[model samples]
Target: MARALPQPRRASLRRLYDPQSGEELDQALVLWFPGPASATGEDLAELHLHGGRAVVAAIETALGNVKGLRPATAGEFTQRALMNGRIDLTQAEGLGELLSAETEAARRAAVHASEGGIRKKVEQWNDRLLNVSASVEAELDHSDEEDVAAVIGSGLSYRRDCIALAEELERALASPSVERLNEGIRIVLAGPPNSGKSSLINAMTGRDVAIVSAIAGTTRDRIEMAVTRRGYSYILTDTAGLATKTDDPIEAIGIERARQALDAADAILWLGDENPDIASDASIILIHARCDEPERDATPDDRTPVSSKTGAGLSVLWEKIEELASRHIPAESAVFFNERQRRLITEWKNRLEAAAQEEDLLLVGEQLRLARSLCDQITGRAGVEAMLGDIFARFCIGK
Candidate 1:
């Protein structure tokens, strides 16, 4: 009897060689996973073959003959990982975000989430909530024997702490800036003619993305470009100059479009040569254009002087933009960003705040429970299989 060589360990790609030839021939790559360390906590196997119709057909034929082997369905591997406690639902979402992230900020956010930032926060909140619930239960159980005042006082203190935690959560969840940062902030450039709106756009993006001209109303349509500053992506829009008494239909249409852009923008860079004043309902940042020229008599609140031609004060403008973005958006601690998370968090916050205001202990307990359940949904601990499927289905199959 001839001794057999030990089988090579399987991997993402493997090679099978002809036994007799000892020369280069057909190959089959194998993938194998042992239990516990595997994503599914079970044995797994895969086969890869050389690129050729005949080779693939041979491998498939061999695999079909094997018992208990089947093609993996989309998300089956990730779903198994979830079921086996290898990863949580938030991690799954993070994976999707990681795949789709087009900017550095978005990628960082996804990496933070995948590293358990969101899950850790949710767990902390849940732990606090559980403690509060236990204390409430204790008070309710011993209501008769203890001094009623003492029991009530202790319950009140616990309620206050719980209410404070809920308020903090609400603030975090209410942050729209974090979502905007991840999704790309919309910054609209608006000013009167010859205010350097186009120049500023070019300077910020480090490219001639817009047409710059000495004449007024050169830009009659809205132009958008993606600008990355400090690892954040901003969808910067340079709209036609906003001015009065334009009879041209195209100019009128451009003005209307500018107004619409301002309304939808997260921030406005209002350029001005004389006064730095531009009226708008949007959050405005006053920028004194033509800073290369000598300082003229002008008084504008929080005005930043910028010279796009020489790059003067551009750094300050970028910093100001970052500051405004941070102020409007949530930090990394925010638990809600998308519509689903926002709706759930808002509903829970409303109920919890109402209970905190009420004197009824039973109602307070119920409200706290509801709030915990909502947090549970964020962490996927509340049995959200259907929602998980929908969320993961949006991702590519490999993830």
Candidate 2:
């Protein structure tokens, strides 16, 4: 412990001693910040001690005997920051994401959020909403005093503003969700039996995740592997071959699961010679696999011919995959919302849209207020008690 508190916000090297026994302790650098201006909007101190268990334990022991001194619990510092208005809920969530980010894209997106990208957007939306709300309130206040024609004209303008704000929210919602970004784009390999689907997956991932074999139905279940390719994340799935018919019960189950995977895929790598028959919104890439083998049929003009065994055409396939993936990946600088944030914003947008459509000024006003409340929850201004614990629990101690 320091003999005296260091100059505010300045790290000072100091000698340490045990107050109870007057024994010399390790030298350390300490910095102090007075209340209301620090990270938590309260007095704060940092001790940069030598990184050793004994050193930390000694400091903890000395501090433990002091009145009202204890270690922070999980996310306590950040929770306090939120409670004290040092940072909003979105930033806290972003910090959590930053801690767990695995890929470069995830890290960049998390950095944007942690730096108040989403909060600033919410603030702008809130300002616009308040402007529209003010108009609605004014109309309500002067309904009898104002000319009927003038009231109608101004009301139209206010509703237009509401619609514009709703459209903005709609565009934000249309962007790929943060969960999808974190979980990676779902790329499912679907084709007939012995069509080199397994080999293609192993080639794409640069590892043998799925069992490749000449026998049909070797992959009896879905084999999911998350991989990062060229700074983008992808969840590559090698599914059981979609055979025309099956008598075995387990293989049948796997075939059914393969069909399900097709439905959920963001991109399909179809290794079969024929065109895919499944009805899906996912991008389908026709592939002519085993191109290096003798007596192989002519490669179709529309299909991407590839040889997983020799690594031929893998670069072109990767380029095509990356091209499709780029459409789903949001720009690093762009602001995107997580599931909770998106849900709140969606409700807020719905309220705004309803307000724009409603003919009754009173109803419009109510909708505007509800929308504002949702914005509040987005920034942790109100009505977030139930989710606070869940959010904070994501962070470890000393966050």
Candidate 3:
């Protein structure tokens, strides 16, 4: 510990010493932030010590020996900040994203969110909803009074405002989800046995992640490889060849999983001669594989002919894949919601829509109140005790 608390909010040169042993531990820079304005909204101290494992260990030992001193657990500081209203759930989520962000785009987006991008938008929605709720309350309380009735005007305006807010939030959902950005776009490569699906995936990713073989049903499961290209992220999935009649149980399971992958795919490269019977809304690109062979060089009207052996037409395939992915890639400044936030916001939007449609003032008021409570949950102001453990668990210690 320092001999004296460093000048408030300023870093000061200090000699750290072991409290019990009275031995100088290190010469370091220390900072002091007095209560109510610190990062955690509590009195805080910062130690800037030399980059040495022994130094940190000694300091830890010293602090451990002190009464009432203990190491902060994972996300403890950030949780304290949230509890004290220094930051909300969204910002805390953003900080977690920032810490784990692997790509430049993800980092930039996380930075924006961590700096209150989503919070500002939510605050605006809250204010507008509050105004609408107030108007509804005024009408319900004073419908008998002539002047108040005139000002309220049959409550059409507030209803319209509620509808408009709902529509706005609906549009906001069009932005790319945080999960998509974090997990990368799901791109599945699928086709009949020995249709060069494995070769193509290995070529696309420049890594031999799948076994290349002439034998049928070699791939008995999905092989996934994460790829980042042109500042966009993609998960290239090579699935077991879809055989019409397979007796092996493992191959059958693989084929079934391939179909499931198609269901979840953002885009599919169907490397088969015949058109695939895909039911999902995923973008399916018919692929003419082994185009380097003279007989298979003729590409159909919509099919992209690619030969992984010679790396022929791979760039074109990438262009098409990138084009499909670009539609879901959000702008850096755009607001993004994770799965939980999106669900809550969707519920809030639905509540607002219900308020807009309801004829009964009491029901409308109830809907508006529920909408407000959803906003509270989104911001971690209420009803998030069950979620705290899981959320903070994502964060590293002392964040």
CA lDDT of each candidate?
0.73, 0.89, 0.89
Q: Relative to the unseen true structure, what is the C-alpha lDDT of residue 321 in candidate 1, on a scale of 0 to 100?
A: 90
* Top-lDDT candidate index: 3
Model 2 lowest lDDT segment of ten = 148-157
Reference-based TM-score of each model: 0.79, 0.95, 0.91
Model 3: per-residue Cα lDDT over 130-158, one tens digit each: 98999899989998999998888856687
User: How many residue pairs in model 3 have overlapping backbones?
Assistant: 0
Clash count, one per candidate: 5, 0, 0
How far residue 258's Cα lies from its native spot in candidate 1, in Å, is 1.7
Best by TM-score: 2
Candidate 2: residue pairs that collide: none
Better by lDDT, candidate 2 or 1: 2
Model 2 CA RMSD to the hidden true structure, in angstroms: 1.9
Task: State, as a TM-score between 0 and 1, how close model 2 is to the true structure.
Answer: 0.95
Which regions in candidate 3 have their CA more than 4 angstroms from the true location?
1-4, 154-156, 244-252, 331-333
